[model samples]
Target: MHELAIADSIVQIADRHANGRRVTKVQLKVGHLRQVVPSALAFSFELVAQGTSVEGAELEMEEVPVTGSCRGCGVESRLKEFPLQCRACGSDDLRVLEGEELFVESLEMEEV
Candidate 1:
């Protein structure tokens, strides 16, 4: 699964930022469009984190709903369904405001 690669990257980032500190939590912002299966990602994270500071750390994911601003109608809305269209007007010219992001926001480290 691609989650393995994603988790590997996460561990690498966390380990790098942690600077040898023990990580207790890893906060993430995951967009709906990413289609990440939470369970799989968690499992993958655990597997990838073996022997690293991130091991046993909690993986907290915040699901970012798909939101966009319509260029035609100048309306901002949450796009629920794909063939992503503007809610105000039937326009495909949407500038995505949020969602479609996979970021490691922060990490909580153990006491030094």
Candidate 2:
């Protein structure tokens, strides 16, 4: 699954930032459009974390909803399904505001 790749990236980031410190927790911000499975990501994290400072580290994820701004009426809409359209103007011309992000927000670490 792609979660394995994502988890590997996360581990690499945490390890780089940890600077030889033991990672305690990783605060992750995942967007809805990423389509990432939490269970799979958690499992992958644990597996990728082995033999690293991030081993045994807790993974906390925050979900970000898909938000788009309609260019027709200049209105913002929270799109939940396909065929993303503006709620107010019913326009399909929209620009994404958020919900495509996947990044490590913060890392809690202890001195090794």
Candidate 3:
């Protein structure tokens, strides 16, 4: 699953930034389009991070919804998927304003 690779990347980054410190938590911002299962990701993180600096660290995910704005009708709508369209005018002249994001927001650490 993509979540496995994503979790590995997160653990690597956390390991680097941890600098020998024990990681307590990692906060990630995941968009709706990612379709990442938080529980599964957490499980993967535990597997990938085992014996690493971030072992036993908590995975905290913040879900970000996809939002689109229509240039034709100046309307905004939340997109459940891709190919955003204006709800008001049924126009395809829509611009994505949010979503499609995957980033680590912050990390909590404790002294080793």
Query: Given candidate 2, what's the lDDT at residue 81?
Result: 80
Model 2 spans > 4 angstroms off: none
List pairs with backbone clashes in candidate 3.
Answer: none
lDDT of 3 at 71: 91
Whole-model alpha-carbon lDDT for candidate 3 = 0.91
CA lDDT of each prediction against the hidden true structure = 0.92, 0.95, 0.91
Candidate 3 per-residue C-alpha lDDT over 62-86 given as tens digits, one digit per residue, 9 for 90 to 100 = 9999888899989999978666678
Reference-based TM-score of each model: 0.91, 0.93, 0.87
Model 3, C-alpha of 88: deviation from truth (Å): 1.8
TM-score result, candidate 1: 0.91
- Model 2 earns a TM-score of 0.93
Q: Candidate 1's residue-wise lDDT over 1-112, tens digit each?
A: 8889989999999999999999999999998888899999999999999999899999999989999999998999897678788888889999998889999999999999
Alpha-carbon shift of residue 29 in model 3 (angstroms): 0.4
Clashes of 1: 0
Query: How do these models rank on TM-score, best leading?
Result: 2, 1, 3
Cα error, candidate 3, residue 26 (Å): 0.4
Which candidate number would show the highest TM-score if scored against the true structure?
A: 2
